[model samples]
Target: MKFGIIGTGTVGTAIAVRLVEAGYQCLGVETRSARSYARFRQYLNRDRMPLESWVPEADLIFITTQDGMIGSAAKNLADRKLYKDGQIWIHCSGSQKAQILKEDPALPVKTLSMHPIQTFADVGEALKLLPGSHFGLEGEAVEEGIQIVWDLGGIPHRLDPEGKPLYHAGSVMASNYIVALADMAVQLFNLAGIPKEAALESLIPLMQGTLRNLEKVGLPQALTGPIARGDSEVVRSHLECIPLELQQAYRALGRSTLELAQAKMKLNGKEYPRQDLQILNYLLDGGKEKNNHGNCRENIRSKRNYC
Candidate 1:
């Protein structure tokens, strides 16, 4: 099948290069910027053709522009009446639904969203990461999109249009939030007098090991450290020592982690003693009280169910 790409960014260039390598003919690319077009041509050795000439001729058209411009790009061709009856129109945005291509229910062409769930820093990275990546697919041409993903050596996951936001949220937490958590760890290490560079070097291996544990043992089982062991004293120490700015975030994460600890204990046919569980929950919940030793005390004075 012949394919034309309407954007000349990293994704578009990488897709064109891979598709040509997969024996798909190129109907040429379309882009407004001369610099982008030059880069696209450099990668694929294909001429930049006008929209009027390529849209009707190509079997597949990829609108690989940034998220905000996808609708405009599709509208441009739709207004020009350039789309053919059986052609496939696709976008690579993770969060946008394919229906943005055309709102008309009777539109003859098949519109689809085929988002590769991987990060790309450049064209080379995109080409390297695109294969074996999971793609979230939706819209009218899902079966055809699945075949296209197979051609690109990608895994395909069918998604409901209504679920696109949540799907993309999970991807963001997995990819982007990891970076944020690493930064937070580094900041705490710096506060402890560790150099930023040294802290990062030490933290990287620990993070990698945690990821390996997750892959090997799977969730709930992979959870570790003080909370997993129901060590309320350690958690109380953390709350007292950490900066006030970070306490809320730590407590929020701890609350969620405590639930995982409960699950892990249940899976092992063991559970935290009721007093221990209540103390851990109270510490994570930011309850403040003084015991006889002038230290933070658990909410044992109240008859409330911390569970």
Candidate 2:
């Protein structure tokens, strides 16, 4: 199929290169900035004509522009009557639904969003990573457009249009938050006199092992360490060791761990030892003076059913 890429950013370039390599005809690319146009020229076939003259020739168009620029770009293309009937327009933004292209109501075009669940530091790296990635697709014309993802060696999963934000949030948690959490780990390692590079290297094995465990056992069952074991003393020590600025993050993760532990049957419904429970309650309660009058012992008593 002939494809046109509307933005020459990292993702757009990567997608263009992939399509070209896969023997799909890449008609041309369009970008508003002169600098971006220069960048696109580098990767594109020098003999090919400019995008303004090529868009009308494409059977499929990829609106791979920045999230904020997608609607305007689509409208501009529609204004020029660039797309023909039965043409397909796909965007790569996870947070955006296909409705963004509704600005061109007269066009008999199929619009869809296909967001790959992978990070692209650059075009070259993205090209190497695109294969086998899961793509979240949503639109009125999803089935027909999904062939593009499949051609790129990606798995396509349909998502509800209204659930796009939540789906995107989940991806952010998995990809972006993991990076933030890694930074936090590196900071903690610095306290132990390990240099940033060394700390990052040291954590690689642990990260790989944790990933393996998740793959093998999944979620709460894969959970380990103090929270899973209901070792309130270790939990308390962790709280004490964390810096004041990071205490809230620690507490929040700890509470989440507790919830997971309970769900996994690691912790009984009854609370543990009174002293341990007191420490946990104190840490979880944000230093509030809330009463801990419930059955702490009963929480631990429920653990017998877990095994």
Residues 28-102, model 1: lDDT tens digits: 788888988887777888787678877898899999988999999898888799889888999999989999988
Count steric clashes of candidate 2.
Answer: 9
lDDT string for model 2 (215-292, tens) is 998987888887776676666555445556767877888788777876776333554555665666676767633334
Candidate maximizing TM-score: 1
Question: Candidate 1 regions off by >4 Å?
Answer: 289-307
Worst 10 residues of 2 by lDDT: 298-307
lDDT of each: 0.87, 0.78
- Cα lDDT over the full model 2: 0.78
Instruction: Please report how far candidate 2 places residue 53 from its true position, in Å.
Output: 1.5
How well does candidate 1 match the true structure in TM-score terms? 0.92
At residue 108, candidate 2 shows an lDDT of 89
